[model samples]
Target chain A: MNDAAGKNTIERAEPGEVGIVQPRDFVSTGEFVFESGQKLPGFTLRYETYGRLNPARDNAILICHALSGDHHSAGIHTLADRKPGWWNNLIGPGKAVDTNHWFVICSNCLGGCQGSTGPSTINPQTGRVFGMTFPFVTIRDMVRAQKRLIDSLGIESLYAVIGGSMGGMQVLQWGIEYPAFVRKLLPMATTARESAQGIGFNEVGRQAIMQDRDWNHGDYPKNGGPRVGLAIARMMAHITYVSDASMDRKFGRKRTAAESSTAAYTFDAQFEVESYLRYQGEAFINRFDANSYLYITRAIDHFDLAEAHGSLEKAFEKIEAETLVVGFTSDWLFPPEQNREIVLALLREGKRASYAEITTDLGHDSFLLESEELYEIVRGFLK
Target chain B: MNDAAGKNTIERAEPGEVGIVQPRDFVSTGEFVFESGQKLPGFTLRYETYGRLNPARDNAILICHALSGDHHSAGIHTLADRKPGWWNNLIGPGKAVDTNHWFVICSNCLGGCQGSTGPSTINPQTGRVFGMTFPFVTIRDMVRAQKRLIDSLGIESLYAVIGGSMGGMQVLQWGIEYPAFVRKLLPMATTARESAQGIGFNEVGRQAIMQDRDWNHGDYPKNGGPRVGLAIARMMAHITYVSDASMDRKFGRKRTAAESSTAAYTFDAQFEVESYLRYQGEAFINRFDANSYLYITRAIDHFDLAEAHGSLEKAFEKIEAETLVVGFTSDWLFPPEQNREIVLALLREGKRASYAEITTDLGHDSFLLESEELYEIVRGFLK
Candidate 1:
């Protein structure tokens, strides 16, 4: 068995579990330049890896995370951990991105609030949180940072770069920025460019956070800023992440018995869906930084491959990755047409690309949900 | 020419303009009991009417306004008015609602803020603004209050009742509450019951307002409560009112040149869509009351015709009007299926009802927009 720092050498205690994995930090002392021409003297990226790289190092795959995801894409942090990593169901020994056969690497994105250099991270020069001082980071900047991490790990070429939503955008950026370096690309539930509706929704969330008095111009102390605003944003964004049908199936007009007294009308979470959303918002504020949300959503809004490259087809012209773009049938946020558009652009450029659509009621978040259909598609694509 | 108070007898210098209509108030000294058994000792409803009431009083058509709408459904208030009343396109002379042929009566909803006895109005008993003290009012309650106004006007409401969105909910209530009073019922872009997704969105808005410190538990002075919160709510809710395709068509990724500087990333509205939404949010706070928004949305959330009447068919069992429920194809908020569901229940109950689906990119607000198809549908249905 390999004893490398990246490899999960620990024996599995449960089926398909990459048990007892640990996150490591990669601090790059070299200057990093952002897409907006802003520069950082140095940066740290927190990452976790599973399985082992073969002698040839051709089995390395990179996993990118969505808006709220992080480096802990698989495996339990500790034995007492209540939940495994976000993508545990699909990223273990025998899972879709089987750790038994491939070396998997996942990192917190460049402007992420998770264990990465972000707005919440302290500026080494000033010894204060970067806050609004953190430079604008785009999907391209995120991929570029990951490229540095990949280079540090001595992986010259990647077997695949896979992700969904914002992560999917980075996967696309990987194929375009380092065409020959990534042999395969799997992006799901994402668009080449965020739609106007997407921008509008993001703006609402941004406004919610910015308008909060506690936000204090993004200078508030840790865990002390815009709790209500961030929660409200999450609650609203949570709705967009789930399908209307799914919500109806899950919550309907079912009132919370505890809150729905016939005595009087009050502005409380009376409906089960309202209660669930409020809970989601509350839970989110505990983990996420409002400034990071503003930064990340801004990145998403600025992601327009077509606009950047003159045309979507032109953007795919240099892509060497064998791309598989998966779209969810009920994902209204980044609908099937948007996913299909990516493949269509690739095909128009004569690139090796295909599209797979999974029918699910999970909406934009279908990629994170456990689905045998999605599993089969991913497994088969990687194979 | 009839010189009755409801008639717009003034000369119309502009084509199709109702021209200089005036708002009037109806005072009800008797106690008004709400659906939840809460009582209002007395109330005043601000209303406006266009066209003359025929001698038989059967030519009067009751027009209902949506959540943010008011009594001024048609005509210019004065020569200096920047814009005519909302729905002016459809409610003017020779238009779809055709003030030339029908007396159209519209009132600010009972719990509404626009010069109506609502949360923003004074409570005679306490000598303070009703604020959160205003009793919970449902679609049925609003309809009941309007019925009193109609009775005081010496009208039996024999012609028709028409509205969209929240107004549509009220229209349905009118048909059910007084089955024999109304002749034709035209409700568009509304649902028999607000879906879980709908409730979730409403909850987000409520949370935004309630979380605002300036809301002061709904006791803030008139024009001074939760501006930021109310604006954020409006901005988000406005997005739901329009479709993705419509937003794409309207704003796309077009960055506002004045704001899109390459110097640095700022939270200021950069994208045209973002700028537009900010404008929407800001404008909304100037006109809407935060507490009124809470009460109305709660009323909408509580509107469950099926559950309230045991079943949807049971709810439609007493409908004596020839009803036509129009659904907009792009309205994701209250999709065509939801609108069709109402007609389906009516059909199951063997009632005179039909469904019309207007293919448009306007989304839920398609009913309010200028569309020949919708106009034709409304005109033909009313005829």
Candidate 2:
């Protein structure tokens, strides 16, 4: 998320006029007083909410998303001018998230491009896009910012916090860094600590992004952003989202066309698989800010609760939230064993926890896929 | 394999000397006359040998290699200064496939570089490399060339034919294509038919190659030969070479010095892995003709013995050799199940066969890695 607050102040209101809670236009500022007594500002958080907050404001739920997912988690515009949110399927009047029962709040995380400030955002002091100048943010810092947002909204504690992938990193951090504040924790397809292997794959993607000639040290946004690097990065990442078997079952020996099938002639994105990945990259560039990718991935890499607590068992000792962790068997990027590891450690620590390893071969993307089984688990657990 | 006779124009062999089987100067050709009456020409063959041929020439064994491997299966060569073949760890004096007991022959396949003719060879008729003009060759074609070579050398039945990967493909082909020629077979890390998954991975590699502008429709020899495309291809291949666990164990979440690793800026190679793969691509260009990659891989893709016969069982019915099949437990690219399928089909056909699945975390690369167990198996099987 970008630090939008440090810029020329926008209308500062409770945003409660339209059944809103802190509905400010465009920018919201946040600050951090580090454990070392170092105070840092030029921080901000841009957010959105669905449904009404009860007078008690104790019904708020912080909904988190995976990489590239935005704050559009629910609700279609009543005015017929806006599209339904990304998670509209899961969050609605009577949907699984049950907007009528909870004040659903979803925010574009820090270092994000949507409405929040990120690499593409301007550095107020330098009059340049933040690019690499944006201070490196930690997962703890992101959670701290969210906590401030909640505080500003007059909420004492979150009814629940939910997330997946990097968002799951935040949920875990919220439970550990502010245990009492989170009533329920939901993390899917994530690890307590980004394994060396996980980090290695991310490093390669980051390198591919930075190595692109257009990256120009992140200053390329003014010239149209580093699309090629980002695309290449996305292409590399696209593979991790799918299982080898899936790729074969779909595109096996199937040429995109007669011309592009052979090795000798013009390749021209002819394979069905190649075409699919390119589409993912292109669509991604339109909405995602490359700078945010660096920050968010960095934040994820920084998250090591086990290291922070000196051990996995110790980390779970601090997670007081009733936990519901989910994973897929075919999630190679974050295999279910990671969830089992966390669950086992929590059990060892006598922490309230629930773990379920569903059998699926959708790979890491299973969480995002259309799965009745996954939804049932989420609904039943939350209920 | 290629129809060596059609692929390269030999200036004419000077005849066999005491220690040499006739030297093929200028260009070497090995023709495999197909049953289809399609007489594609310009054949070439690159080969290397080890051990002493008995006076009766009845003690010869053939060593085959996988895709991306060549005739350099043994012996130290001053020109290339490469190691003594890939299986050198398992093949040496008094070792498995011992130099003392049997004469061994390994060739670069017809479409390969090394001393053989391929995309880089000058067409005697056109005085230019065939490039895309090179005809698609098959495993049976490769075997046919070997049969001619064997006939030329006055050897009737070979003591054994041993190989892994594509080499293993040849072994399978030899069992069915000419049942009387080979007396024994050792095929490792291979399947009777290249699976749909295998084809998909290969397609990714081929796409990477064809996407490069310098590839120039296989005419890019002067323009650096699709180095980037080939690198990308190699990168994809590298991922398939090891399991997730091996990657985690070897390079998870670790970063080297900025300039020394992929994390920093550099036009030159950064990260040991990058350097390693770059070296692999550069060295490959020097010794390999890209056209051969096209033709040989096409051959592998074209190979489906079950499709040729009515079924895999029918294909295996002709096998007269004592079979020793080996598979790696973690070789996801050609997993144990694939080899087991082949072994099972052979068993279903009521053939004499032995199988072993070596436990290793090395993934598909186990065939190349040093394994004392493999040595013992080969030595004992031969005895």
Candidate 3:
């Protein structure tokens, strides 16, 4: 493995293995101002890079992650890890993203929990965790931060920018905010703006967290957050990630293996789906910060690209990048019709935009799954 | 209006108005045993009737309420009331369910909160609220309880039984368990059994309520239950009640009037849909009992007609009633395909069953709404 000198270098993995890449922190000296008039004195972006940046720096690609995603996008953090990164399926040496040819960078977005400066991070001014005091972040604010990171890397422009769901919102924002800097854009399973149903679901999740007494109005003691409320929030969200068909196929009407044929009729997880959701919720609580979930989901709910630019057509008018917008048939959260709206707007602006509605039972999360069709589409578009 | 003598008279409305039919309680002398082996010493069923039962007593039509419904199926309880009943549009004098032609009965289900012996009711054994101690109720048990009430009214082999959602489950159970009693069955916007997605959503809502510290393990002080948790649960359930199309048409991305163009980015109801849901949740907390909500939803989750009888076809084998199953096109909670499953099973048993898939954007709640097509179908079927 090639080790280039940087701020700090951690252990390297074996050659040919898209293994652990240590994340490095980039602290901005200037204040990070949010659209809401709130500002952070200074902020740090935790990011990881894969592959080598060519001398020309023209091979760089930026990967924006969805809600709850971190900087770890292509490899395991350690050799003992049972699974690699969230997008490891498509972002390896010979994978769809093909890190062998593309120098990929993935950063924990602003107001995220994994490593980026977020609600869980310490406020430089107060010497305490920002908590709810952290200024609410918008997708545009996140893109702006990423722009700073890219500029610092000496990469004038990115070969391509890719993401799905909330990450896709960032990708769209990038195209509008820095049209000349992004060569191509791949925004999958996202809308130009959050829909009413989408906002409603997010609001319920927020309410679930805020209602938790342990949440303490977003000022829970350090490492002591609203686990139960956050778990409930995750459970609610997990249901939306997959389609009804997928749930039926995966769990169906089957009861938990431990549950007897005779109904217990108790408030236990009797159905297999219920058990699965509980497991998912519990697992999420271990990794995600409750306050971060609140901020990020709010960011997503408030995302309306067209609202900022006056109209969708106006939002696309300045987009100079070639775009490939993908949507899944079963994605109720970000339905294919909503994705189509984005492409239609791009087409109306006479921009180089193509649309693909993939038939997948995986729902909105199909963008992160291993699908040959999705792979081919991404490969063709990027090529 | 005709004054029917009962133990108590509440109020009366203007002449020619099907208004203010006071609910009468029928206390079963024997123990009410649940499918889970738990029992209530004696239970009361609060019921309201519209129109007069003829000499033959065969003109009675039973209307089962959905999850949040009560005995108030038609007309206002008092003159000051701005609204009539939940199904007022369809149950008035010359309406589809036509009170002028049929003697209609609507009862609060066995586990319902509104004027029924549910978890909120006092337990004879402990002299305290049943709370979580309430016996687990099933759709079959609810139908059985209704049978006792109908028998008390001297109604044998009633004209018809109709319901939607949980109420529809009761209608199905009535046809299967008391085949000889129900002359016709009208089950709308329901399934033969709860689907995995349905169970998942219900489980999440249950978890939301149970996780609240204020829940006090389902034994919160009188009128001091988990309001926030219950409200969250209501908000979640409300999402499933309507279609994405309906939400978009009703609220879309429109923000609340108070929210400024520039995002305030606060943890408040920014979107109109969010405000609407918050209102729905708050309003529900005023009328619903948390523990009752738990018990009733569990009853709905446990409802599987086919599971009781080896197969769905077997469930319909002994049914003597002419069945008409109606499903809304946009009901993802209980899709048209699920309703068709019931009709298919009935047909497979050589039962006289018809199916109507109404095209509506109202989703699962369409059964309760005023639809011309639905009215025509109900009218023709009852005729």
Candidate 4:
């Protein structure tokens, strides 16, 4: 059952390395009901774990992921894998979330494509890919699914539940749903609710995907579907992930060497930023399912703590976890104000919550990018 | 040659109405060269004029247009017309532009589609639509062509040149290209150069159009071509035209009455903002040519005065006209800082220039929207 056991080839673990890890699946045959009142007969959650559980089983920490992220987060998938997991910089043997002292777990979100039962998964009843047939999911639904996974692992309580962006949404939901089950919550680069601007961006991305003829009403085979449209969406959304200042510093009017020499204008990517965006879009289509993108983004758009609980303050009334919300200075998507709103709401409820504003030019994706300040904050908050 | 003369059927002009106006086309048979070094054998400019030019022809005011704008600056096309010109509010009799005293002239830009010689026009050499074959255009090329039309009108100097957004680009270009030919300039809601973020947004829009199957490589039949893609582009761009605060105020999680009552999930536009964007996208496809959209946006992407000249100061060094650059407070697309930079450079050059910033939640399109502050700034600058 422990898939990561035999994969550790290193005789001596590197100081910050979690070493090679493998994803494992946990299947539950019990009926799963979504927050939208839709139900599935069963579900599978693919996850990766680091370190080991103590006798008391109370030292577990849950790692939730943002949109487009999944199970593998901290270690190399294989010894030959050139790139480590998405959050390898922070969660390791001696890293911020120190696997040495705490057992860490991260799962592919319920409606995710990375070995999780998502839109691309075959529907058991019809023997066909779920596609749009999959029931609508929400931040609460994602948190509940993770709760089941944690319960199955025999963990009675989580030492901490940490995430950023959509993961941050789940983090907030976890605090509300299982108030007494989680000790600490670290939600970063996210909002208590998706703003109109955020919803507008998501809507544009959804339109781009749906506009493609190849989408075939979300019935296309898993191997192919709306590549162009998905790429367009990704290209546009990627722009929102970084700050204007960061983009200018990185690519300011710099053209591809071949493009700069040509006087004739073509529709091809000319600016370095254009080329980078194109690459991002193309790379996204290779791993992401279009229907899952639609579902996840919709869930994000529908996420409003205030609307769900009647008000922002009421949304956090039951939260017992010590919360630390992180906001980035340049993250216009979920600006500092949005992040602070969560802490303010929690404080208003007389809960143990605080706010941290990181000054950075990385924009919304600041949580994923490496930073000493973020690392320190996460480390101290977890402690 | 005076097309607007017989169109005004109103016995008495309304207070601010310029009344009925007809678009006139001026055909030129002489070679017209583009900044890219390509040449057009001849071209036609569709234009409209309000009021009468004095015998000296010194009271004429040239009105340049933004992207997607045309010659119709004031008045209705006919007595039966339901809508007046795009800028009817600001460019009518006794309005800020004051058609009664200034002999206002507006034109469909050189690379525009509204009755102008553009991609949709039949190419003299090929006897077919130019499409992608249309010569690359620039802000300089547009100013040069407008100069020809102005000279043909027997006007030696313009009392003023006024425009916003892309039109503002033209106003700046006019000051540089014809230093002694324009007495005053009003450029608003524009930038001296497109920012990386601006370029990114434009690139996304372009990608959407090009990705459409019906785009037919910009060679599609005039009646049909990438309508969905064009609409998608318009929807995405519409978001940039407005600010976050404005969008929230206009559409804060408000759904269509029918959508709010439904429980099932679908890709249909549920939010009012989504419906509004879809309408904008649909409306744009009916009036705009995909090829023209490509060409005009390309022209905008290439406009960088600092790059063309050694520096912004150098770009303004030759300008002789008194200038006023206006920026809106909430225009994140081309923020006030960018607008202020133009005047800063002009001041560094010891040029007759100043800047005005109007506080508003209307975003980048504030210049087009009715604002007493903008109107006052324009009127005072003109005086």
Candidate 5:
């Protein structure tokens, strides 16, 4: 660990009880010595269990969220007054990821702006916000941090690890970096290695954040720190995430409010797509930190699963996990071909796997949308 | 002609040289008296002379350009020094719409920022930038203006009126609105109607322009007037003009010179895609007015042949012109189906027509690419 040259006031998540074993809830604590040799202290990991964890604790399922999701998978919770997490529709109350029996956990990934060690956290060495000093994180680093979290919880293995889009990417990373820990895997609407298309989109979003005048080299807490930039970035991503057809059916050329006069060509949400994107950008800044948005998206763009394992095929060589890959038909951002390629890679490794391509115009975000068939497929696959 | 409300200046074209002597390059202008009871100014058409106008003035061709193109037909003369215009490869010498035998005329369209009476032109009544005060122009309105230019030049009919994308829309509009004006019509890589999807993209671009701080609601010339917004708008349009593969091959994850560092992670143009977009945006703004971008793109969004002429078939009812419809294999913006629909419309109208679907991954901008085969197909059809 790096030396504690100058210490001052610091705070972190204290060890807490398991708080009763609910199928979709899991929490634990650990420590991580980062690549920079800086030690992260009292890392509290909060996760939720879904479906059944087979007798061996081998049926344990681990889920990872995108940029702004947290551990409270799907249930009634009294912690800090927020609603039951974002993906609750897909993972709770007899849904695809049922809480009837399986053990599911989705911890806030490392470097996340949430309850994770991030730029918002204070540096023990200097007693100041990590800010620009925070060590760069890779998908491997995040998965490694999760591994420590799982180890601390006394969980040796997982039946399946699932994620989509960025989360789907994390799923691939978990499988590539630590094959033995995963017995099953589902990476939906994602790629083994983000193609040039995915990387290009992410890069643009990152630039939007960093170019904001307030960014100040990622050290601008004194100012608002790139909120508008973050909002623009979010708006661009929102367009890519949803399909054109979906956007058309939902928004169209419909004006924000009913047009009162033909002469009144005012600055308003004249089209449905504009209104939707505006809402998306507005809502994003509320829950996400601009700096964290920049950092994590950069990490995603930097991710290369094939390079991580030295070869694309080699990445899956030792994977014994039964894979259930899901892809949405209209996801041009991370199209079906990307997910199909993932399934092909597993097949090349001669691993047990199943693949389903869902027809939907929800685009890269089809995974996040509610579709009965996708739910049915997941339920059966997990069972 | 309704009172000259506020007369200022009148500079007619050099009488003898500009207009063609043959009747083949002509089309009578349709005058649509405005609600304001004013007879709008007429078109001053300019065209090229080809081999013999076939002794019957029947082989005259009309070429049309996309959003930011002009009347230059072919070659690199001191008078024709606009970088050979957009379709240089397909027009000069013995190429498609060959100047060898077919007289080709490509005029600056109505409501264009390019040396035409568009939104930016000074209104004689106010002696100020017309801006939003300029009358709205439809695709058909442009066709009507061009018709006057053709008639004033002594052309009564054309061998063909050919164009791709927005220009294609004009070809279709001309064939329907003024049947006697054309002998053959080609609508290449264009749709019967601008899809809700395409309109959505345009709307997003417009929003970017309007949202720029310097954009004084289309009246901020002294303030540098929305250059950033216009650049961003161009950036978005550039994405639609190319296929994903093209972007990956050309740009991928290359970084800009300013952002690269031995240690620090740079976001500025770090990806080749970023550099390409920035360059496209910067170059685009140099030649385009910010407000003009808004108006022209909206004109495109509002262009739907079927919307104006009822059914796609009815859209071609009175056309006696032979037609050649063409499409690029990779043009998702206006794919093969769009071109096919135009051909189908002509066929239903019993007008002679041919359709060609060129296989290329150059996307909607394929017509602008160096494709000799595409030129050959067009040349043979025109001949």
Candidate 6:
């Protein structure tokens, strides 16, 4: 069925049948004030849900997506679709997240462009799109927006809040901001605060986008965005998502046979890895907004639970949820040490906390990838 | 004295005085052919020499440079100049690469723009800048050009061939291509060949430059080249050059005082690291040519000494030099394992080989940074 926004609603199928959910908008009546002292007047949050909410409404698990991810957390949108949802590997009926048991809620984050009220959203004050005028959003602001969605759904508390990367930031934010409302927390492949090196990388990506002439100071024409800049940004970022070992295993120095039988040695995409990265960049430009990328990444870079709450131990003092902090061994972006910091903080707070460092060459993306180890840990924790 | 091309010759100072040498151009009369089936009619290689050649003419040590480096490896250009040569910290009198004991030769690599025939150099036949027309030059090609320079200097063999990163690649090439000419080889923070991850990074940089509209297919106006693209590329490369631990120590999450006394939650460079990277990018744009960057990075990406010589074991077969492979613990770009690979191969060939894995947080740039351990190693090995 179609919602008022013309977006498709969740399709319920047989217990074992894999099903897709379409994003639906929840328009808030009041203004949402941001940490930057800016406000959005009656913004809309786009979200999707799978499975059925139990009569008690306490079986709801909120799934937070990472950077460049959205409400599509599981299943395929259409039969012809080449790819399933971003976390389809983890959130399927029989997968780690197990939508069959818990009512799953996945929302496009605030400051995101995928059907959410973000930079491309039309400003109520002005007749044009918000462009760069959109208020800056922090992880807390995103969680607050998500909280509003949960409140509207009549869920007093979530069964679990699970996420990786920026999503994991939200999980930590939930633990701090609305501790009582999150019964269980699984923050994977993330840190309490963004590291200097991580910030440096994000800054470079933002600079690449901002420097493009076509960006037009973040007010590019509707159909004409900063493709080159965005592509370059994506190419740079894509490198950080996977480890060196993973790249070696996947693409290596294997040359694209069509480009040059030998070494054409021109600036062409000669290596298979280069070709893969180029494709990622081009594909990213098609799906993502440059301004949204800028805003979301800024939010991530600004994240610091310890800074906000005075200290790491102090940040978890109010947390009532049973937390499971997970990290990927190869995740250089948010190393396991950073995840251990959170676990240690939680332990110091005298809260029930557990940690697992999943060894994988998959890097930061290991949280979403299908692995028996991750699945067992997630299933055991959720149970 | 002024050369025929108006380039200044190296100035001879008093015996004990540490003095900077001016770059002198060595014009090759015959055509210079590239590995990519492209040819240069003739090329002028710009190089700097410090200290005097001994009576035996075998005290010569050729110093190869990494990406973005040039002929000025040590000493200050002028007495009033604030900055000494890039490696002045390690290449002065009584330093790791002592000028007092050795005649040091540093040259702008074959595809370099600094006082050398490169993409920015005018193509005689076309009466235009070579731009993208410059033939692809490999690590072997760079070493070959150095060979010509050495022959012209009447040097029968070099006392040592020393370099790090791309320069290290050149050192390996020298061991295979001109085994008898290089008596000792020190290849630091480098691999026998470029890794998939390394190639991927270089490709991203090249894409960033090529995608810029101002690049104009690598034929941009002399004064109006792709500054933004070049800056972004430099920023990306800079991140790889320094370690995560180093960045944390240097910049941390410390916010820039101007952007926000606290976190403004804005997209602006709130972090000091961002400011540092921006400065690096801007400063790099002032000194480097975009086309030269493209060509040089390509040469690095295409470097595969083992592949050229059939295998790693075979590559070291002709190496007559006593080799020392140096690696920095924190260098993820060219990790210690890669350095160990070379040492292992040399040992397999029954050659005089030693390896030193320097404990440093300086990353790939550790070779240029001050370290007493490295100093002792170099001093002992050279002696």
Interface RMSD of each: 1.2, 5.5, 1.1, 1.4, 3.3, 1.0
Residue B267 error, candidate 2, Å: 13
Clashes of each: 0, 23, 0, 0, 22, 0
Q: Which model scores highest in DockQ?
A: 1
CAPRI-style docking class of model 3 based on DockQ:
high
lDDT of 1 by residue, A1-383 (tens): 22464455344547678998888888999999897889999899999998888888899999999988899998888888999889888898889999889999999998898889999999989999999999998999999999999998888899999999999999999999999899999999999999999999999999999999999999999969999899989999999999899999999988788876664566777889988999999899999999999999999998999999999999988998899999999999999999999999999989999999998888999999999999999999999
State the lDDT of candidate 3 residue by residue for B23-128, as single tens digits.
7788888887888888777889998888777777778899999999998888777677898878888886777887778888899998888878899998877888
Report the C-alpha displacement of residue B181, candidate 3, in angstroms: 1.5
Q: How much TM-score does chain B earn in each model?
A: 0.97, 0.86, 0.96, 0.96, 0.85, 0.95
Q: Which ten residues in a row have the lowest lDDT in candidate 5 chain B?
A: B1-10
Model 6 per-residue lDDT tens digits across residues B342-362? 999899989999999988888
- Which pairs of residues have clashing backbones in candidate 3? none
Alpha-carbon runs more than 4 Å astray in model 5: A1-56, A67-73, A76-84, A114-134, A207-228, A251-257, A260-267, B1-57, B70-74, B77-83, B253-264, B348-351
Q: Each candidate's DockQ score against the native complex?
A: 0.83, 0.23, 0.80, 0.69, 0.27, 0.81
In order, what lDDT does every prediction score?
0.90, 0.68, 0.86, 0.87, 0.67, 0.86
TM-score of each: 0.98, 0.81, 0.96, 0.96, 0.83, 0.96
Candidate 6: regions farther than 4 A off = A1-17, B1-17
- Cα lDDT tens digits, model 4, B36-97, are 89999889999988877777778889898988899998888878889888888898778988
lDDT of each residue in A227-331, candidate 4, tens digit only = 998999898899888978898899988887779988666678888888888899999999999999999999898899998899999989899899999999989
lDDT of 2 by residue, B1-383 (tens): 12231222112221221122222322325444543344545465666556666767788788877778877665454434445567766665566777656777777776666666566667677877777765556788777766666665567789999988888889999999888878899999988877655655565456545645567799865436766556555555666777767875775444445543333322233334444444555566565555566667667765677867989999999898888899999888888977888888888888888899899988988888878888788888898
Which residue pairs in model 6 clash with each other? none
Candidate 5 lDDT tens digits, A1-383 = 00110010011211221222232222333556654455665454445444444456555678888765666555544435355456666765456775545566777776776667777666767877778677766677778888876675557887778888888888887877788788778888887766566666565556556655567788777337766667667777777877667766776555555552443333355555666777877788777777777668767766766756787788888877788899999888777877888888788878887789998877877887778998898888887
Candidate 2 fraction of reference contacts recovered: 0.20
Q: Which tens-of-lDDT digit does each residue in A170-286 have in candidate 2?
A: 888888888889899888888887765455455445654554446677777454766755665566677777776777677654556654545432334545666677677778777
lDDT of 1 by residue, B1-383 (tens): 23454554344547778898888888999989987888988899999888888888889888999989999988888899988889988887789988778888899999998888999998888889988888998889999999998898888666999999999999999999999999999999999999999999999999999999999999897768899999999999999999899999989988788776654566787889998999999999898899999999999999999989999999988999999999999999999999999999999989999999988888999888899888888788878
